[model samples]
Target: MGKKFFEESELIINADGSIFHLHIKPEQLAHKIILVGDPGRVSLVASHFNEIESEVESREFRSITGRYNNKRITVTSTGIGCDNIDIVMNEIDALANIDFNSRQEKENFTELEIVRIGTCGGLQPHTPIGTYICSEKSIGFDGLLNFYAGRNAVCDLKLERALLNHLGWSGNMCAPAPYAINSDKELADRISGNDMIKGITVACGGFFGPQGRQLRLPLADPNQNEKIESFRYDGMCITNFEMESSALAGLARLMGHKATTVCMVIANRYAKEANTGYKNKIDDLITKVLDRI
Candidate 1:
């Protein structure tokens, strides 16, 4: 069978031959990529690079390619949600394996090693503020991966069933079904340390209702956070809540790439504590990832 061609609307390339949303050319990318949520953090990651080869900025997506410890790496910002993660993951894969000029798949494949470094609100007591949490697996409350075909092929079905049963999620609540995806074990282990807590992470769709943070509006399940905190499967408990990770790990798995997320705990939902001055902690985390990746 012949390869299918990607439609112009589906695979958008700028006139300058760069990816549409990210505004990054294929050559500017690196096999080792670090994803950050805030665009401002891209520069911080690049600062540790010995030599920066290229930098591109468009919309909330900012990219920088450089060398860290003689290994070429690219640091890019993905804004703040799984929706954005959908865009970033697909385009990054396309850049690595698609022929933009022909809009077709390349004969050879280029597998990427992607790592997401972000801040999260810790759910477990052990994951208090200033702690580092490496997501061995991510629970997707975002439902971004559900839209794609073969989602279950890349997901953890047993874990998903356990989570759904624990949450008592029904169709009537208009809640998105939760899914689970394990991180690339090699990548997760590489970025983890004795001080880091390796556990399940929740990738939420929204900040308020999705994460049990009530403000002006009321949540359908007021005890949602409590239930989530108590839930466990195969001795793995959900460690923290973040905006990305599930989609990154899911899409990367489906695309035959290595992906994982490691986050710094800036807030503890269990302890009701937050560290607003988390810059130093994140800097330390970045250095750890750079050295390991």
Candidate 2:
């Protein structure tokens, strides 16, 4: 078969053969990547590295590769939302599996172990502030996955239908049809510790209206949080609300990579509790994830 060609517009690469958005080459990355929402958190995670190898930043995406406990790992900041995930995941996959010179896919695929460490808001009252939670399943309110073909093949249709029915969603409550995807079982098991809470996580598109936070503008569904909190399907309930996990897990699965999310609870919506002093808790969570990963 003839080698496939990618147009410059389609597969954009710098003159140095690095990916356009990330501004990083394949060699600068590790097989295991820790994705954070805040760029500053990249440095926080890399601070524990025994030896720092490389650090690169472009826009909101900051990547640092180093060795920790004799294990090579890369920590990259993905900004926020599935929009950034769309870019970051595709570029990371390209760097690992595509040859920039020929603009062709490699014969052998490189599977990545991606773990997202971020802050989240607990939806259930029982989930206390400063608690750590690992997502067994991520439900996305964003439509990024729907844009891609074969998304249904990767999603949990039964769970998705149940949630949709529970919400009474008829294309008016939200724009995108919600879908659920499970985390990599091995990574989930490895990342979950005795203290970590495991449950379904809802990835909202926005921080305010989408997450049921009231501001100057009225929300389309003010009871959104209540509905999400009360939603249960076959013993699975939504435990927390975050912005990125769904796309991360979904895209990782579609790209043949293993992925999971471990988040620190900074706020509890049901209890109306917010922790202003959670830095130390985050530090401890980071340490725990680093040790396990």
RMSD of 2: 1.3
RMSD of each: 1.0, 1.3
Model 1 worst lDDT window (10 residues): 167-176
Q: Look at candidate 1 and give me any clashing residue pairs.
A: none
lDDT of 2 by residue, 69-169 (tens): 98899999999898998899999999999888888898898999999999999988768898789999999999778888889999999998888777778
Candidate 1 Cα RMSD after full superposition onto the native fold (Å): 1.0
Which stretches of model 2 miss by more than 4 angstroms? 171-174
lDDT of 1 at 131: 92
- Determine which window of 10 residues in candidate 2 has minimal summed lDDT: 167-176
TM-score (C-alpha) between model 1 and the true structure: 0.98
* lDDT tens per residue, model 1, 237-292: 98999989899999999899999999999999999999999996699999999999
